[model samples]
Target: MTNEKKKNTITWIALVLLTILSWKFSESLSGKMGLMVVILASITKFFGVSLQFLELKKAHSFWKFGLLGFLVIFYFLVFLFFS
Candidate 1:
């Protein structure tokens, strides 16, 4: 398989795992824990994508970081509003 296809597959798998983990233990986990998870995941994903962009010499690093920031903010707002 091509590198792009492999990367896409890995991304999909990561998303699926995140969704499943959230769905399975969301009730049992405290709001704070959920928020923490979201924050950590966002940061990790941001760094991962940033590194990939740097390694691949992509021109959209800024855009990717902006989206990541937006997601982090959105997640924080949701956590605050719900909790």
Candidate 2:
């Protein structure tokens, strides 16, 4: 297999593992802690999908930074709204 395919496979596996981990954490942790953990995992998965599948890794720095900044505000708002 090609390197790109290998990377995608690894990323997919990682995302799956993270989802399972977050689910487990939700069952075991308190409300605030579980929310934080799940949100962190979601952010990670978002970046992975954006950079790899969406081809954002090759995007110009401005676009990349813009997405990052946008997500920061969005996630912060989400956390505030839920917490």
Candidate 3:
């Protein structure tokens, strides 16, 4: 297979696995650890989507880092104030 197709297939598999794992965590985990796990999983999936599906991997460094910074700040704020 082509390299690009291979990369996409791997990413898609990872996304599916992460989704299933997150759902399992929802059922088994609890409290702060659970919240952290969920958030990490969500952000991981978000990153994958942004990179692979949203086509952000080729984005300018400024926009890329800016989005990453925003995501970090958002995660901290939500975790800090809400949990």
Candidate 4:
């Protein structure tokens, strides 16, 4: 397979594994631990889909970092408000 296809395959596998792990965490865990694990998985999947599937990897640095900054602020706000 081509290099691009390889990357996609790897990313897809990663996302699947993360999903399953998060699901199990949600089932067996609770409180802050479960929330943190699910949130971490969500953030990883967000970046993976954004960079690979949404073609954000090739985006200008400004736009790329803008998304990162947005996520940071959003999560920060969430933690602040929830905590």
Candidate 5:
């Protein structure tokens, strides 16, 4: 496979693993770890969606970066809410 395809596959695999691990250990894990996992998963999902959209539309850099920033802030808010 091409390098880009390989990278995307790996990223998807990692996202799935993180999602499962976060769910599995959420109750037993420390609060901080749980929060971190949730944040990471959220960020991963956000980037995955944003990149896919950008690729499809050949979107401008500003929009991609703006979406990323929004995702980061959204994750922060989610963490705070859970905490």
Candidate 6:
């Protein structure tokens, strides 16, 4: 397959693995620790989606950084507020 297709496939696989891991963590851990793990996994999945599916990897640095920054800041704030 082409490089772009390969990259997308890899990203998809990573997202799937991360989803499973988060689910397992949720089941194994309770309270704050589980929330933290799930949030971290979600942030990682968001980046993978942005880069692979949204084609943000080829976009300008400002847009790329801006999107990721927004995700991190928002998630962090939520994590802080809740925990």
TM-score of each: 0.60, 0.88, 0.89, 0.87, 0.71, 0.90
> Relative to the unseen true structure, what is the C-alpha lDDT of residue 69 in candidate 1, on a scale of 0 to 100?
68
Local error of candidate 5 at residue 71 (angstroms): 1.0
lDDT of 6 at 46: 98
Residue by residue across 1-83, what tens digits does model 3's lDDT show?
99878888999999999999999997899888888988899889889888877778899988888987799889988889858
Ranking of all candidate structures by their TM-score, best first: 6, 3, 2, 4, 5, 1
Off by over 4 Å in 1: 38-59
lDDT of 2 by residue, 1-83 (tens): 99999989999999899989988998998778888998899899988888887889999989888997799788889989999
lDDT of 5 by residue, 3-82 (tens): 77886787678767877877777767778787787678667766775575336226787876677777788788888888
* Residues 1-83, model 4: lDDT tens digits: 99888989899999999999999998998877777777788889989888987889999999999997799688767766655
Q: Compared with the true structure, what per-residue lDDT tens digits does model 6 show for residues 1-83?
A: 99999999999999999999999998998889988999999999999999889999999999999999999999999999888
RMSD of each: 4.4, 1.3, 1.2, 1.4, 2.7, 1.2
Candidate topping TM-score: 6
TM-score of 5: 0.71
- Model 1, residue 16: distance off in Å is 1.1
Off by over 4 Å in 4: none
Task: Name the candidate, 1 or 6, with the larger TM-score value.
Answer: 6
**CA lDDT of each prediction against the hidden true structure:** 0.64, 0.89, 0.87, 0.86, 0.72, 0.95
Measured by lDDT, the strongest candidate is 6
Candidate 6 residue pairs that clash:
none
Q: Write the per-residue lDDT of candidate 1 for residues 1-83, one digit (tens) a residue.
A: 99976876786677667666655566567767766775566566555555453442365767666766677788778778877
